[model samples]
Target: MTNSIKPRLLLEIIAVGILAFAGVLTKTAANVAFPAMMAAFHINLGTVQWVTSAYMLTATLVIPMSAYLQRSFTSRALFLSASLFFTVGTGLIVGAPSLALVLVGRVLQGVGNGIAIPLMFNIILMAVPRSQRGMMMGVGTLITATAGAIGPTYGGLLVDRWGWRMIFIALLPLLLGSLVLGLVTIYGERRPARQPFAFLDYGLLALGLLLILLAQNGLGEAAPLVSLAEYGLGIICLFLFAYRSTHTATPVLNLAIFKIAAFTWLALTYFTTFMVFFKYVFRPTQ
Candidate 1:
């Protein structure tokens, strides 16, 4: 029984790992095409970078809402829907003849990727035994790091060989395979639905994303200080979000999670670690 259970558990881990890898793949696939996109669209680097920036902006804004969605929908349903959205978005980008359509596709991809990432974490927590949680987390970290290490090089090679559209094409099979596996192996677990959604909080999140987009567009060699201001404004908006989330009845984020001392300390530690790692990884001189 123990031997049989081990193999089944390994299969589950692989399934989740593949799904998580798809998310990283989507993010990295576009890196090589960035320059091509700018040249083809006749847009400046700052404007064209929105292809990446918009995805990130949308992801950041939408992630907080995933808690509510998770409450209402099954994991299988959420995973399937997110995968479909990502796949559709990639298809659109592959076929897009115009810049506007490309941007639209990227926005959709961002939303899908955003929802999928946190859901992956949730899946790991729920599926793995407590005794093995640390091991699973280590596995996840390794997968993420491996993806990051290779993504840029791989993307560059693909773009050099096949052009920008090829990146989108590359993702289709992976997404389809993951979607099928997710449906077959992942069971739906239900939870009570969240109460009526709050419109104001949603609006604020949208505004914050817009501000981030603006900041990303504005910040470059041509206008560094102005871009900084735009980014600063976005940070302010995030603080506003925190305040509103705490005060409102139908908050988008559950502030109650921080009430636990362990949760709070862990969150702070994670934030610090993330900051250090990110700075080291992305240092300008490097």
Candidate 2:
């Protein structure tokens, strides 16, 4: 690459990496801050957990729809929207008076996060050359992995010395830098022609995912029978979604990826890694 192009590409990668790191940090930090949040909000463990679980559900729900969204929207537009949603969510959480508002804030942040993660990957693929793609991906992984590794420790220190809100507050400068750099560097992708969006398919997929997350959360908190019923309903909806993907012209999620053996193995590996990490992180400190 030319010297001029190299600097520009570097800046773009840096911008995307920073945002990804911040998003991951936000999620992991909240995990550590749960006890403090519960105490301050005057809520029980079951209720306080909605703060994190709701965000996870919202983010997960938004991801499948991203393929269509990226097709219909400009990269700049998507980045700006993501930044706005995240900023407003952070502001709300920082100033929220009640648990409800905090949950709302978390959902908005989740939406922003959902949009931002895919955009980060897409940007690297679009802007970086094929020769450099692998290197850039490694950088992306490093940023996210480092953030995930350190978030709880950082959050714990802040929570102990200051408060939970400080976590969000401390993140503001990095978030703002990301927004500014994104606005400056993320340009040139023209919007694609809008495709017909299948509302019913999307609704079914979203509802299915939502119920699954809710049921997962409810396992110990809700009665066993109620949890079982919710889990059953979620499974039914998911099966319907899988069936719809086969029949529909433009399914929100392309289930065909599952046909690849490597993809399935990769997914299983991710799940196993997450479970191990979660157990390690949340195990009793003693």
Candidate 3:
């Protein structure tokens, strides 16, 4: 901490951080509520698990679009949209009578999260002074980490007392606070891209991701041949998506960043570690 920071500047970061935190918290907390959710809907474990899957899948798909979103829209617009999507999704989840609606709500929440996460980093880099960026980035990461860290415990306690929907209900005030703070603190600045949307790139990417997730989710249950076909198709789609991204002039994702040897290795390391840990944590307890 070399130099002192402006109050409003910090508030701006706090606004986005809170939004991101809420999104992360929702995702993690809902996992603890799965048992309650299944009982409430009279569904089995596999079926109820889609609540988390729908949310994660939607978030994963939307994440790749974040780079494009930043290029096309103002930070203020994006944050506001995120807030709205999240709020509406929470509402739907709280009021849902059927599992179908719950899944839809989770998907909407995922969309909000996917936007808020990248947008948080975008804002920090764009708004925070270079000297203070590291600290602010840490603050942002702390907010996210804290949310995920305590989410399971928080959900467990709340679900035990007030039921599964209470997990979302508890977030209403936080969501409103974020929206209000965003209105006051978030700025409107746009640097629109001058490039055509490459439908093929995003199409392949989305299809690939969907296939991969579906195949993974259905691994034990689905027929061997079907699973193999899906895995094969998914890999091919991703390969095409990557090839197109590298070769295109206005790529949705800048694959060039991975050209840095250190960065590529670090990313792979992080991905593999997170995947292993994630499976361990999310595994169904027998």
lDDT of the candidates, in the order given: 0.73, 0.81, 0.85
TM-score leader? 3
Cα RMSD for predicted model 3: 1.8
Superposition-based RMSD of candidate 1 using all C-alpha atoms, in angstroms = 3.7
Runs with alpha carbons beyond 4 Å of true place in candidate 3: 1-4, 190-194, 284-286
The TM-scores of all predictions, comma-separated, are: 0.82, 0.93, 0.95
Candidates 2 and 3 compared: the better one by TM-score is 3
Model 1 clash pairs are none
Higher-TM-score candidate of 1 and 2: 2
Model 1, which residues run further than 4 Å from truth?
1-13, 191-194, 220-236, 255-286
Between 1 and 3, whose TM-score is larger?
3
How far residue 149's Cα lies from its native spot in candidate 3, in Å, is 1.4
lDDT of 3 at 17: 83
The reply for model 2, stretches above 4 Å from the true place, is 2-5, 282-286
Per-residue lDDT over 149-260 for candidate 1, one digit per residue giving the tens place of the 0 to 100 score:
6666677778889888887788788777877777777677566575688677777767776877787666556888877887788777777877888988878887878999
Ranking of all predicted structures according to TM-score, beginning with the best and ending with the worst:
3, 2, 1
